[model samples]
Target: MNHEDAEMELTADSIITQRVIARPRPHRPVQAGGKVGAVPDAPLFLHLDAVTTILDSLAREEPVEAGGLLVGHSCTDSSGPYLLITQAIPATLARGERLCLTFTHEAWNQMLDRKQKEYSEELIVGWYHTHPGLGVFLSGRDLFIHQHFFTDAMQVALVIDPADFTWGLFYWQNDELVAANGYYIYGRSDQTYQALAELLTEYGVSWGIQTEEVDYNA
Candidate 1:
């Protein structure tokens, strides 16, 4: 599978674009429950180390925002869930300058040209951006742009709020807009790890019950 180089309808000049490679859609809905563990098998576990690495790269450049492509493996086992196996942080662009989100057209054409040459086939799966003074949630303009251009539900959208150190995930389901159910992950702190783990555990219990969990991890 390959994508062509097309102009991205950026919502802001400071927008940073990232991508992740995903398997073709799963045959099943994965799970029908509403929370993380609700459909435990549907939950994705991102490597804390990998996530940390991406953040560190961004931190190294400070004021300027960074973006890149995410590559990972997927399965449907107990370990069947999606995991952020690895990541590729591209060069950084100035915070207030907008640029079209493209992988050289040549890169996108080959799907995994560069990575494949390195013996990997990870493709574009999602995007992430920093919200400096802006909040962590997706703005109206952000939603509109994402939906209009990238309509894939498996496509992940992340917003990082540097000021408050908060982060969020978003995914689209047909016409219904939805966000990931989990605690925020950011910076060098592991304070939210325990909460996130507990939340996922409860979500697993709720999954068996065919309902959404009331609790949320911070």
Candidate 2:
């Protein structure tokens, strides 16, 4: 189906439920130099509002790296397990440099408090950060953070380059990290999805669903 059609279906069925399933353990061997090998079967779905929020936060922190934790729930459809990211909670106490970000203990405490108070039903599905002009790829430090904190297989890391609007998502698979070539953004209204598509297209990124099976060794 096309993007419009897919959005329509998702909007018609917007009730997202949380499911408790055994976390997929990392088993894929890490390649040399910590480079990601291939795209995993898991997919990520973001609400249109969540995307807008992330972009706005990134724009506000221009020239320096900015990041935040993602809030959402996981569910299994006929297609398989996927994440539905509904919120983007910016790191209020994060220290950001040109190439790195350090989330303080206060940041973690605040995030946990907010999750308990406001988003008790959602999980910290992943995180996102901007790279300024550095391009879209996970650094060694980024890999370390993901491995230690977000160890769950479904947890993902999103890297966005505000200068060029390029972005990528990385997830754990077979003990290795895999970059997602494509993802989905579900909206409750047609205008929302249209705006999202336009935004991604204007930034030179493909917003449509990926059709080709990811070749891991490529």
Per-residue lDDT over 144-175 for candidate 1, one digit per residue giving the tens place of the 0 to 100 score: 54665445445566665555455565665566
Distance from true location, Cα of 44 in model 2, Å: 1.1
Candidate 2 residues 27-77, lDDT tens each?
121111112333434557667567777877775635988888887877665
User: Superposing every Cα of model 2 onto the true structure, what RMSD results?
Assistant: 12.2
CA lDDT for candidate 2 = 0.64
Model 1: runs farther than 4 Å from truth?
1-42, 60-64, 78-85, 91-119, 183-218
Could you estimate the TM-score for every candidate? 0.52, 0.71
Query: Model 2 — TM-score against the truth?
Result: 0.71
Best by TM-score: 2
